[model samples]
Target: MKRVLFLFLLIGFISKAQVKPTIQKDDIVRIETTLASDKMEGRQIFTTGVDSASAFIEKEFSKVGLTYYKGLKNYRQEFVVRNASANNVIGILPGKSKPNEYVVFSSHYDHLGKEENGKDKVYNGANDDASGTTAVIALANYFKELNNNERTIIFVCFTGEEEGGFGSKFFSESINPDDVIAMFNIEMIGTESKWHKNSAYITGFEKSNFGTILQNNLKGSKFRFYEDPYLEENLFYRSDNATLAAYGVPAHTISTSKMDSEPNYHQLSDEVSTLDFDNMTEIIKAIAISSESIVNGKDTPTRVQKIR
Candidate 1:
């Protein structure tokens, strides 16, 4: 009788595992390579490259069965920055029960366009943000497949982040901050963290209990999320999450880049070849798993303190 019960449990576990949508390294590679390729021309804001990249993202969202946000005809959330046209590709997966409450996943898609000095003029920006954008796409596909989110999920690829975060600033003004439950702004996960393998850090870990909620969700997993090591840099307010965070939303940026020693940082050498696709795949998977509770409305992160 004991053996029968053990077998039944094992079968159930295997079935659940089979049904899970695993984020694959190949998917990461495909998305990152295309976005970081020379043809993209670095995806700089106000450049043809950025427009092409936004179009590509829109196609991917449609392919994944994501629809436009409410009252929008298409996925491109167009805006202007310094009189230059900019776009934020947005897709929505409405929740089953609580469609008004939102859990946002964002990544900046813009990068340095071209350098004048070097023969390799293109700044690929694979590690700076292409990796994060790839993760956003993969996460969208995963959630679409699972079809189990209880709170609305918003996937956004922002432009003009490198040019002073105009995209996010505009977006923040357009939304009601109270409806936003949490924001996961993924950035620079192409390489492993300085802490060790399968680890990443969240900026402004002390600003709220958001990191705690994430860590608690990841209990028993090998992946570890830690506090930002370079607190002195005030990294929490430096990224695209800052705008929403100012309005008291629990927004944070997740990354694994070693700011002090990262070789490729903003240079033209930051290409897809420089990234570790395996580590990136693991990071994306960890985010998807840890965010399950928030997406399902089982957990809500503490609000960040409103900045003056």
Candidate 2:
């Protein structure tokens, strides 16, 4: 009887030690709402709205205990594109072993600021990219708490994606492409994919084995990551991932928006209410889990063929 009682106590202790994660649906909703609100003025580059968005991202990074990247005093990495000044908010969670290698999570925070002729002037980009930005924060917090990564994880929220991927283009020039193991660029995950339930898509899925690795990690799970359905649209080159992919980095964008049917794309009607927070949470969690092998340095995805 004493042995049985001790066994029960041991199980109880183990369960207690496994604390629940803080990245909940409510947290996602709150962050998305704030980032996509009218108060942000659509987060356009060179606008006050974009500045406010960057400041909020910095605060969120600080709250989650993510350290600023090396050679920087703060989270904001400011750069210039033509005459316009832009910043990418970056934070780092150093690895337990292979600190020199990097696995990056990126999302652009900028959107079309506002429209002149529309009756609804504010272009709140709730689904366009606020959802992606929220995932970056959520993943950062999740990884920080778990503390199990083997390769350094960099979380970056870029500013000039709306203006022809300028932010990522500038950022790609700053880092040595060889050190970057992979980049998962999250975009427009606020809605369900054309697959409609429990699935998302990856652009440029055939360029490398990146999607295969992610799907392999999610074996036996309901959540699925598939190839982009809108191949004819040439989505692979459209988003922030293109810059690094051009340099042979295994970078791709994950998204749930149906390109042909997504009604809210670049419209004034894209608000927080239109998003499905539960689905968003599931996608973010799946990203965290699917990235485990890469983060641990156990799986190295094949590099993309550099485009001329």
My TM-score estimates for the predictions, one after another, are 0.94, 0.95
- Across 252-283, the per-residue lDDT of candidate 1 in tens digits comes to 99999998889999988998888888888999
**How many clashes does each candidate structure show, in the order listed?**
0, 0
Off by over 4 Å in 1: 1-18
**Residue runs of model 2 more than 4 Å from their true location after superposition:** 1-22
Give the alpha-carbon lDDT of every model: 0.92, 0.93
Per-residue lDDT of candidate 2, residues 198-229 (tens digit): 89999999999999999999999999999999
Per-residue error at 68 for model 1, in Å?
Answer: 0.5
lDDT of 2 at 284: 95
TM-score of 2: 0.95
Best by lDDT: 2
* Pairs of colliding residues, candidate 1: none
